[model samples]
Target: MKDFSAEITYKTSRSSGAGGQNVNKVETAVTAIWNVMESAVFRFDEKLRISEKLKNRINSEGLLQMTASESRTQVQNKKIVTEKMLDLVEKALFVPKKRLATKPSKGQIQKRIDNKKKLSEKKENRKFRF
Candidate 1:
């Protein structure tokens, strides 16, 4: 979605999950790597935003990595990994709307106080007399 295809690199290895002998013979696992620091797809602010939001995923060398091995074919695995990587980057780039702090309205506050008073009155009425 962000035109990161040019900046991504892929590595393949034997898939570990399933496929028995086929797994041993073929390299279906795909690892997608992107160098965030050297990426031309994002501006400086966006780069910083991604780095900050995805700090755990990005290594010291500024490489963002994702792996996919569920598919039996290398091409399918590559596609899955690429999609995952794009989703990760897109999520990291998103900025949430800031929240504005405000006090409760006078009527709301009064309603809360009234509820508390009613509860207290009920509790007091439940007390046993000597």
Candidate 2:
């Protein structure tokens, strides 16, 4: 739901993969770059969360870059890259629920011990004895 239009910039270049003859003639690849450090739309906490969650995507200058070249036309590629960037930011802002540690139930622990005993007895019975 965050508006990143003002903070995002796009760069286009000839797509190296797919598109056959059109790849050589037209620049279809779109790279959408968003500067997380300078973004006015996000609060300090949100920016910190995004930087920590998307550390691999963010470059040294704190720019999050996403590229798309699946479509033959530049406009389609631009739209795809833009959507990808937005999705990335949205995911980065998500907070995961804390996991609680719990001990195994008594019945479950007993079941495991019973299984181990059964396996040990079975193996002992298989041994060659005179």
Candidate 3:
């Protein structure tokens, strides 16, 4: 996997949770900001695809943003945000292959019809009327 770390910009702020006094004093939370329009890593079409696919995550300024504060330490949180940003971009650019149309073979269709007839006959016979 190509590391797109060069394309990202990180900001730090004081985060909440799990650290003693450090939580209030130190900036542990990491926010990764990547400008989709400015990134040279991807082509124009791929950038468009990423923008459209991740519209909710992208801001008005066209920067894709992700934040990580789950960890108590700055390094760990930075790792989390970077990985998350990469993963989100990877998923956004993904396009699934189109499936070909298929039909049941003649024998399989006949067998299905035969089974339906058998079921219908069995149910009809179960109606025990004089």
Measured against the true structure, the TM-scores of the candidates, in listed sequence, are 0.92, 0.80, 0.94
Better of 1 and 2 by lDDT: 2
Score candidate 3 by TM-score against the native: 0.94
Q: In model 2, which runs have C-alpha deviations exceeding 4 angstroms?
A: 18-21, 127-130
> Residue 89 lDDT in model 3?
87
Worst 10 residues of 2 by lDDT: 1-10
lDDT (tens digit, per residue) of candidate 3 on 13-122: 99987889999899999999999999888889998999999999899999988899999989999999998888888988889999999998999999999999999999
Regions of model 3 farther than 4 Å from truth: none
Which candidate achieves the best TM-score against the true structure? 3
State the C-alpha lDDT per candidate.
0.91, 0.91, 0.91
lDDT of 1 by residue, 23-111 (tens): 88998999999999899989999999999999998999999988899899999989999888888889888889999999999999999
